[model samples]
Target: MSYYDEIEIEDMTFDPKLQIYHYPCPCGDRFEISIGDMRDGEGVGVCPSCSLMIQKRGEASNSSCGYLNAGYFSSTISSATRDLIKTKQARHI
Candidate 1:
């Protein structure tokens, strides 16, 4: 699975309400993935608006996001990042 770039987990934006991490995509959208999935051993944040995807590097547990004392977005990431690929078998919505 090729990605545009490898972004460190710390560089992604954490949305507490959705328990997800997001990063800006050049496609004029955002690449989003859920925090739970990250903790569950998932990587790759996909953009909702286009075919582009970004690979997540590092670990959520190592990130400084206070909400992640290690815990959980985008199956419905954000209005900007919703509907990204659900890498897991269990879909959030």
Candidate 2:
């Protein structure tokens, strides 16, 4: 298989409940990696149904779960992100 390409962590979505980071894969599946894995310096994201993978690149921070307490705002969520979050939440329900 060809080497996985590098993708910024900003391009991925974090599931606070699952504590996993996910990005869309070309194979109609998602590439997933964990916050713990990133903390342990494991940056490779793998697809469950395909040979594809990606290397996550970004500084590890306490706000990886998209929440911060006191004096820290990583980024604002757009309507699309809100919809995606709702969908994920619904699926988990």
Candidate 3:
């Protein structure tokens, strides 16, 4: 299967609440893949607004359940991110 691009996991933004990682899509949508999908050995992130998809790479070690570790995101994410998540969650509710 071919992909529109190959992106590193570190480049994607992970949402702890949703357990999903997302990257920008030219279609004005985000390419997303859930942590469950990765743990199941699926690495493809799909854009909801288009047919384009990207391959996610860089899971060299288990993050406890076999995807990425919480620490990986922790180091990359700051408290501001948590606030953002909260704001998003509030809107969805």
Give the top-scoring candidate (lDDT). 3
- Whole-model Cα lDDT of every candidate shown, in order: 0.69, 0.71, 0.74
Best by TM-score: 1
TM-score of each: 0.66, 0.65, 0.65
Candidate 1 — which pairs collide? Answer: 20-73, 34-73, 36-72, 74-77
Query: In candidate 3, what are the lDDT values of residues 1-93, reduced to their tens digit?
Result: 999999998888877667788999988899998866875679999998999999988862344232233444666668786465446435544
RMSD in order of candidates: 9.5, 11.4, 10.9
Candidate order (lDDT): 3, 2, 1
Could you tell me the lDDT of residue 93 within candidate 2? Answer: 47
Off by over 4 Å in 1: 62-64, 68-93
Worst-scoring 10-residue span by lDDT in model 3: 60-69
Model 1 Cα lDDT, one tens digit per residue, 1-93 = 778999998888878887788999997899999866775677979899999888888765433364422333323345332223222222522
Clashing pairs in 2: none
At residue 48, what lDDT does model 2 achieve? 97
* Number of backbone collisions per candidate: 4, 0, 0
Predicted candidate 2 versus true structure: per-residue lDDT over 1-93, tens digit per residue: 454688888888888656689999999999999866775678899999999999888754544644532222325546675565446445544
